[model samples]
Target chain A: MNENRNNLKLGIFITLGTICFVAALYLLGAKQNLFGGTFEIKAIFNNVNGLQKGNNVRYSGINVGTVKEIVILNDTAIEVNMMVQIDVHEFIKVDAIASLGNDGLMGNKLVNISPGGSRSRTIEVGETLLSINELDADEMLRRLEETNKNISLITSSLVGIVDKIDKGEGPIGTLLNDNNMALDLAKTMTNIRELSFQTASLSQNLSKSFNNFQSSENTIGMLMNDTVLAAEIRTVVDELKNFGTNSEKISSDLNTIVSGIKKGEGTVGTLLSDSIANDDIIKSIDNLQKGSEAFNENMQALKQNFLFRRYFKKLEKKK
Target chain B: MIQTKGQFQSAKRFLFLVGDIGQFTLRFFREGFHKPFEWKEILKQCGEVGYRSLSLVGVTAFIMGLVLTIQSRPTLVEFGAESWLPAMVSVSLIREIGPVITALICAGKIGSRIGAELGSMRVTEQIDAMEVSGTNPFKYLVTTRVLATSLMLPLLVIFADTIALYGSFLAVNIKGAVSFQLFFNQVFETLEFSDLIPSILKSFFFGFIIGIIGCYMGYNSKKGTEGVGKSANSAVVVASLMVFILDLIAVQITDLFYEL
Candidate 1:
């Protein structure tokens, strides 16, 4: 009986140990989503970024599956196969995007899946999903270096512009810094003030002159205001009109006489117009000239002769 | 000159001892398979080595877990990762600490017990009597005890691990509140099949080394009653040393298979 009891205790101890082992296995397996209806899907990536088999696959921040296999297809690409729960496969659509991500800032690498749009159909088993490779540390460092260079360039240019402004080198700088221009502006303002004062005085004088004209204090004002003087000036203008009418009549008579003379109806017209009379006049003028010359010669002879010389001298002396 | 002569005699005896132990292990393998299978002896051993040692193993495991948690708390708290206490304790205990500590305890407890018991039997000529009575003494004695220790150590380690986690759970609640479900969830979440399988497998090796060392020492004891005490003492020393060596090799082998 003691032997049997000992065997029974031994059996119970073994059974309990076995149960604990099985429980541990079940817990670990369930955590990896092993004991479930699952579907397989593949994704191809340029790089897995150190993702390993048994890494979690998450959708919408919830773990849905685990990476089952990773195969390097070529030098540039890799194929990752994931075993996902069947219930979550509905949330993963045909056009869903898969990418590598970290569990936390410094945690394990995992595959993150973004649910597809409403237009996409639900993903089927064995379908290949799209994958995006995460940026490697080297690529991120390179980008950071470029950004640092750009920031330094911008800061240097800004510093140069600030230095130039401080030295008063541009239009804005001259406006801020040139003392001569400010003085010139002040002088011009003073000149404008003087000119405005003179112009005000001139306008005041013109107003005074206008007031005098309105009060009939000047000739122009009296000429404008005296009605009798205006009427006398009108009579004088009437008399000048009568005189102009008489002069016009006399000018007409003179025009008639000039027309008759031009028609050769008078003595002066006959002398001017008759060619025979013109020759007779010319002969008479020539006879007169000859006679005058002969008379002048006789007179000269008389003055030079002894008998007439004395009488001509006495007449000259008396004159 | 006398001391030098004595050193040289001791060295020669040590080499002879090595050869004798090797021969005994080889003979165990030879007789182990040709056995009139000793199921009754193996079962009785299991009761003694596994069930009877549970309280001692349990107390040691609880202290290890409690002390590990209490000690590790300040450091993790400094990093603001106090919540990770369960996972950290679970992984450490399951993967390395629990198995090794339990095996060392067994090496001291069961290994020495087996060594002394067998040494007494050998000195009393009980083993020779069995041999003359037309029975295989090695097959009946060494094979059953070795098999029992090998099988029972792993089960004891599993029990030790469970109790250790419970102790850690208690320690965790001393300063903070955590639900049993959440703490266990965190523990299992951190534990992987690789951590568990390799550790349990190494415990088997630890058990085998303990059994073989104990049986070899006792089965080949000399000098009568004085030899019995020496066998028991050397059995523990060699078994405990062999446990560490095997643990190192096991870690290397596990790393080669899993890490690479």
Candidate 2:
């Protein structure tokens, strides 16, 4: 019994120790997501950026999987297999983009999946997702180099512009450098000041003359200042207004008469509007012009004749 | 001439001692397999070596953990990585400190006990008497004790590591609070199989060295009562030194295989 008790005690101690060790192992395995409803997926990358097996796979900043394997497919590409939890599969889509990310600035490399659109098909077991390579340090450095070149170009151009300005070459430089232009501007400003001063004095004199006119000392002033003269001017303005109204009525009558003539409503209207009458008038004017021309021709013939020439010369001497 | 003769005698003695230990190691391997397997003796030894030494190992490991945490706190806090306390302490304890410290403690406690017990038995002619009584003394004594130490050390180290991590957890909470789950998560996250297996494997070597050294010293002890004391003392000293040496070799081997 004593031996059995000691053995039992020893056995229990050993068992407990072994349990602790195994528990540690189990916990570690669990942390690595070893025992789970896991599904495998593949992502191919031109470069994995030092991503290793057992690195975390995060979705929306939460760890949902682990990198299971990394196989170099060729000189240019590598295939990374990941074991993700099955429950998170609903969140992952076929169009999800996998990219390499770091845990922290100097921490381990992990794969981060950008959640795909809701309308896209969900990712299934063993399906491949598109991988996007992060901008590596070298790529960033290369871009920085280009930016530096551009900055240098801009800076050099700026320096050249500054140099031109310093040399008084451009419009800005001329504005700064032209002493004669500055003096001319100053003289023009002084002339404008004097003109304004003279205009002010002339306005003051005009106001004095207007005041004198308003004192009832001059005829024009009396005409402006006297109440009776003001009444007469108002009466004249009223009569003018009446005459303007009468003239407007006469213009309206004339417009009516013209419109009646256009429509051939009266005798004069018929005469003006009738096309035959207009033809007769044009014929009469033409006959009159012909008679005048005939008369001039006869006079010229008579002057050429000896008898009429002497008679015309005596008439001219009597006039 | 006298000094030369003394030097030559010592050199011969050293070579004979080496030869004797080599032969003893071989005989242990040979007889260990041919056993009416000493399960009972092994159990008793497990109790003696592993259970009895727990307090000493545990206290030392706890102190080591606490001290390591306290010492490493300032540096890690300076780096703003105070949160890494559990992981760092766990790695150091599991990979190196826990195993080596426990093994050394066992060397001092168990090694000395085995050497003295066997030495006293030898000095008192009990081993010879047991042999005369038609029992295989080597199997019953050296094999059981050696196997027991070898088997028990790893388990002890596991216990030590657990206890030390607890101490570290306490120390971590002294300055700041960290949940047990988070602490353990950090620990397991930082630890790899490479860190664990190599350290546990090396403890077995340490155990074997301690057991074999103790057994050898005790078996080859001379000059009666004075020799028993000397055997115990020399066993502890040699075993402790061998623990460090074996640890160095184990680290190198592990690095070569795992790191490369």
Candidate 3:
């Protein structure tokens, strides 16, 4: 009787434990599409990489099934078969795209399916899912390498430009480097300012001179009241003219005498016709040429000398 | 002379320990497969280890789930992901907490009991008497006990996980409300075969270690009554240690395969 009671208690415990186990199994298995109506779909890939069977299959981010098997078709291609729940099969279409992706930032591989074209027909059972290869890490690294090369080239060009700018190698460089250009600019500005001031003063002086010219209290104005003096001046002018004609006749006689002297007609003429006179004239002309050459040499010497330069500067200041 | 005798005795004891445990494990495997199976005894053991441990496991699981939910609430709120609580709790419980809690309870309850009972039997020579009789003591004792623990613990874990999720649902309702249907849907929705299988499988390993360690220590006990106490104590300690070790190994394997 005691054994029977113990057995019964044990039976109760066992039954309860079994029930719990079964319940848990049902819940967990149900979630895995084990107890549900599901359809299978196959997909072919160039490379499955780390993907495995029992990985999730999702459509538009919602998990619909699990990978059932993975097979190698050739050296390059892999085939993945998935079991999707029947209820979600309608979402699969004739042109649905299947690709490998990770679950989260840190998660296992999953098969993600993109929705097919709206105009396309729904997918039938036993039909293959179109496979897409994502931009994997290696491809991303290759792009990064290209980008880095471009960046380096750009940076080197920028450095070269900066070096040229620093060394002042172009027109802008001359503008920056030349001290004479700056001095010339300053001198031109100063001269323009002084010229403007002088022009203003000259305009004022000219206006005053014109006003003085128009005034009646001048010597030119007294000449208008002296008509009788003007008539007496005319009589004196006629007498002077007769005397001027007599002087002209005597001058002409002198000119004839000079010509006879040149011919050696008289005692004075001999002296004028001598070779010593011609020699004396030539000597004077040579002296004049030598003096001019000496002047030119002196001027050249003066231009070369610092003292002469100072004297020229003083002359400029006086001007 | 005394030292030499003592050394020889210690060496003998060590040999006996090895021999006894080896024979016990071998007999357990053999009897596990043997015909005219002791289903009654096995069921009884399942009751003691599985059903009886449920209340304690359920309470602990509930509290664990409640605390995990409440603690995770603030962080989830910060992320504006309070909706993820049900799924998160379910995954955590299924993957780790459920198996560990169930195994721990079995270790404390079933492990100590097996050790103490078998230890007492050893000290009293009752086991020897059974062996001397026409009955096979190993089949009657070790196999049934080991089978009971191995089968019961996984079942217990499943129950514990279910109750814990219920507790988490209540916890979620403390500051907010999620419909029971929605919560359960979310819980099952986020879970996959990967999460379910690995956790369930690890519990069997936990059960095996708990059973074998308890039986080993108790079966090879010495010093009569004092040995019985020591056996019970050591069984709990060693079983708990082995549980942690097995859990570590299971986690590594699960990570290698599931990668989740």
Candidate 4:
């Protein structure tokens, strides 16, 4: 019984030890993806930061694989080999880009593989994954310095503009500070307004005077407004009408005489119809024009022969 | 007169302690490697130390795992890390609780037995007879008992650790929900070779301390049966204290190496 018991106890210890070993193996194997198919891709980076060989490889936030190896290519560049799940092979493409990213702000760093576009060709086994290096610390600091300088300049310019406004030193200042200019403008506006008012009053007065003269209310108003001028005009018109009637009779007699002359039956008509009579009238008119011209010239010659000057001198002495 | 008296008393106690400790250690080393290997005796001791103590260790480990899980829940929840229960429990078991609880149980069970048995033999003149017969009394007595404890305690710790994890599983399902397989997965996933190796290593130290202290106390016992009882009680006390001390040193050493 004791011997059997001893055997049984030994058997138990061995079995427990085996169980522990198997359990540890299973855990390690699962982590290494031993039972699953996987594909490999490699990428080259200028820096790996803190990325390690066993660090996770996340594709679109899902942990699809882990880093297999990391090698320093040069002083400045590193090459990372990753084994991705075979099932996700279709999602990876030749143009797929990889970037080193941290798990969180303070968490471990990992490699992040961006899903390539559908249009891109599927990546083949052992193909090198494209890598994009993040901005180096020095470059980032340089850009930050440039940005800060620009901000400082813009702020200083803004301060200068604000100072100018505060000092009231430009067109805006004049508008704000010059009260006399405002007063002058106000005075000019008042003068124009008064002149317009006076002009309006004067027009009103003129209209009143015209109305007084047109209305038959007083003597002058009556003379201007009543029809007395019309009566005088009518009397003149009656006299003109009588004159026109007498003229008409005289014109008829003249027409008869002219016709008799044409027929050579009256004295005036004979004179008009006779050629000798016409020539005598023309000769007389010519003689009269010549006599007038000669008299005017003799007067002028007599005045200029000192007689006009002597008379003017005698008249001046007497005055 | 007073100073002389105190000095004399101290000297006597010191001599007695030395004689007992020396004899126990010497016999332990001797019989441990002697011919005839004491396989039967070892088996009987193994049953006594390991199998008989199973229920007590199991019950304690189960409650320990359950209580630890329950207590840890609110704290982990505060950090929003409730899912870390399995990993956290496994680490605690492998590093701290597994070795500690196992050692405590052994101190209570095995340490007292070794001390009392040896002390009894010393008082009863069994040790004197074996010495007279040239059988090497300390060798037969101290060696086998110490060897049994040293070997058995580690095994017990291993069994205790396994049971503790199971207890943690049951505890996990009490107020929370985690499948057994999944719990074990999470536990093993976070547990590395470092955790396993260090914990297993520390349990051996615990066993050694228990064995040495128990055999040392019992072999040096005096004052007949009363001395035997006193030694047994003191052995349990000292061994338990040693367990904590050794655990502390183990942790420090583990940390020093592990941090690198």
Candidate 5:
């Protein structure tokens, strides 16, 4: 009885221990996808950043698979084979990007399978995924050092530019530094101000003159505004134009007469042009004068005769 | 000259003691596995070794886990890695602390008890009487005890590891909040077969050392009450030392196998 009880206790102890061990083992194995339906996929990388077999393969930040194998293909290529759970396998398309990343800061390295573009086809078994190699720590630190050097160079150049500006060494510098130029500028500004004042007063006086000249009392104003006088003056000017035309015609006729006389074309032209005719005209004029004097003497003799004396006395008394 | 001679005699005796233990171990393998196997006594020893030690181991494991968590929390909090507390503590306990602590406790409690019991029996001529009666005392006592420890210690370590993690969960909730499911999930997430298998495997060696050292010290004890006391004292000390040495070796082998 005692032995049986001891054996029973021992059995219970062993059974409980086995239960714990098996439960823990099952959980860990399940995490590794030991019992799950899974498919394999491949990726080639230049570097894996120390990712190893059994590292998690996460899809879009969720762990969907685990790395099954890591093989060094050549000097530059590493082939990573992953066994992903079947349920999530559909989400990983042919163009999925496989890269390496960390679980947390200072955590284990893992394979990150980011989903591909929207239109990519479903992934096939054992198909190689496109990969972007993670920048290792040494490379990142090297780039940071280069950037620091460049920043120092940029800062030094900026300091030089600032110093040059402080010393007034360029076009803006000259404008700042030359005292005589400032004085000339001030004088020019003063002259412009005085000229503007004078211009304003001159414009005012010109406007006043224009106003005065616009009234009809002024001659220029009458010439501008008297419509009737202007029309009369226009008529006189027209008559004067006619007189000029008539004088031109008369002068033409006189010119013709003078030319005819010079040519000795008529009797008056012959009397003027022929010297013998002119002398005969002078002799006839002298005989006609002598006859007129004899007539007058005869008439006086008849009035003194007695036969007509009474008739002459009666005509004189009637007068 | 006299002191040198005495020092040389002591060294020679120590060498002879080692030789005796080795010879004894050889004899145990040769004689212990043959017919008339003491399965009943082995089962009894397993009860004594496994069930009797369970509470002590469980309580010690709990305190160790709780204390470790509380101590580690401030440092992890400094790094803002308090979320890593479960993984970090579980790995520490499983990989190093659980096996070593449980073995040490057993070495003190079980190793000394076996040593003193066997030593008193040997000193009182009980072992000699068993031999006269045609019973193999070494097989009946030493082999069964050793086998019991070898088998039971791994189970004890498994129990201790589970209890320790429970204690750590409670400790984590002392100042902060974490669900039991989440705590366990985190614990199991970082634990791999590599971490789990080697720890439990090393525990078998720890059990073997505790059993054999205690049995060896007691079986070869000098006569009298003083000898019994000496054997018991040396068993605990030597078993504890061997447990540490074995732990060091286990860690080195694990590292090599895992390529850590």
Candidate 6:
């Protein structure tokens, strides 16, 4: 009976111990993705940032796998093999990106697998995923140093500009500081206002003259506005135009006649242009003069007789 | 001159003790596998060593875990890492505190018990009677107790670790809120096979050391009640000291492998 009790106690103790151990192993193995249907995929990176085997592989922030192994391919590339649960296979595609990240502020390194575009196929077993190198501490520090230098330059420039402005050295500073310039600018503005007032008055006067020209009572306005006078004037102008037309016709006929004479084509033209006829005319006049002279002699002889002398005396008394 | 002579005598005695232990270890290996196995006695001793020590180890482990959590809370809270309570406590218990403390406790309880029992047996000539009767006293007493301790200490450590983690979960709830499932998940999340298996392997060595030292002291005890008391006391002291030394060696070895 004692042996039986001893056996029972030992059995229970050993059983409990075994249960504890198995439970621990199950939990730990589950965490490590040890007891699951898993698939392997590769990621090649320029730098892993201290990532090691057994580190977690997360899919869009969910822990789905562990880093199975790491191989240094060359100086600049490293190959990391990861074992992920088969369940998340569809969520990870062929074009998925893998990058290194920390678990927390100061935690272990892990591989982050981000999903790709929906059009891409799911990643195949043992396929290598694309890697994007993260901004590591060194790179961040370098960029920060550059930014600091730029900020320093900008601040220096700002200080120079501010100093110049404080010293009243530039145009803006002079505008702010010079009271005499301000007074001149104010006077210029006032003069411009006075000139605009005078221009407005001149415009008003011109407008009044235009109104007077538009009135129907004045002669100039009547010329512009009286319809009856305008029509009469138009009739007179029409008659003058007709007269001018008639004069033009008469002058045209005269021009034709003159041109006919100048061309020596008619009797008057022959009389004017014939040099032989002119000589004959001159000879006839000479003959006539001679006959008149002879007749005058005969008359003188009759006057010497009594009857012709009495008739000549009576014609002179009548004159 | 007398002082020099005394120091030299002490050195000689220490060397002699080391030689005796070495011889004793060799003799155990040689005679241990001989026929007439002590299976029934080993089972009985397993009950006495493992099952009987479970309650005490469990209670000690619980207090240890609770105290550790409470003490570590302020520092972790200062860093805003209060969420790491479970993982931190679990790793601490399983890695170093759980196995080593369990070994020390066993060295105190089981080691002294084995030493006193065997010492009394030797003092009363019970072992001699067994030898006269052609029953091997070393095989029956020393081998069975050693075997039982070696087998039981690891089981005890596993129990202690589990109970301690439970205690830590309770303590975590004292000042904060954490579900049992979440706390245990956090604990197991940080615990890997590497953290677990090496510690467990070291506990086996711890057990072996405890068993061997106790048995050595007790089996070779001088003939008297005083000698029996001395054997029990020396067993506890030597076992405890050996536990710490073994733990140091275990940590170094674990570190070396972890480096790789």
Whose DockQ is greatest here? 6
TM-score on alpha carbons, each prediction: 0.70, 0.72, 0.63, 0.58, 0.73, 0.72
* Per-residue lDDT of A88 in model 5: 90
Indicate the worst ten consecutive residues by lDDT in candidate 6 chain B: B251-260
For residues B179-237, write the lDDT of model 5, one tens digit per residue: 99999989988988889999999999999989999999998788699999999999999
Two-chain complex of model 3, DockQ on C-alpha atoms against the true structure:
0.36
Report the candidate with higher lDDT, 4 versus 5.
Answer: 5
lDDT of 1 by residue, A94-158 (tens): 98999999876656789999888978999989999988887977789999999999999999998
Candidate 1 local lDDT, B1-260, one digit each (tens):
99999999999998997888788889878888774888888889889999999899999999999999999999999988898899889989998999999999999999999999899999999999999999888988899889889999999999999999999999999999999999998898678888899999999989988999999888878899999999999999999998999999998999998883
Give the alpha-carbon lDDT of every model.
Answer: 0.90, 0.90, 0.84, 0.81, 0.92, 0.91
- The DockQ scores of all candidates, in the order shown, are 0.63, 0.60, 0.36, 0.11, 0.62, 0.69
How much is B167 displaced in model 5, in angstroms?
0.6
List candidate 3 segments past 4 Å from native: A1-16, A47-49, A74-76, A88-91, A102-108, A171-319, B1-16, B30-40, B68-92, B125-139, B168-183, B245-260
Considering every candidate listed, which one attains the maximal TM-score?
5
Backbone clash pairs for candidate 6 read: none
Cα-lDDT of candidate 1: 0.90
Candidate 6 global Cα RMSD = 14.4
Residues A186-270, candidate 2: write the lDDT tens digits. Answer: 8999999999999999999999999999885689898988989899999999999999999999999999999998999899898
Off by over 4 Å in 2: A138-288, A292-319, B1-19
Residue B234 miss distance in model 5 (angstroms): 0.7
Q: What is the C-alpha RMSD of each candidate to the true structure, in Å?
A: 19.2, 11.6, 25.2, 21.7, 18.7, 14.4
- Backbone clash numbers for all candidates listed: 0, 0, 0, 1, 0, 0
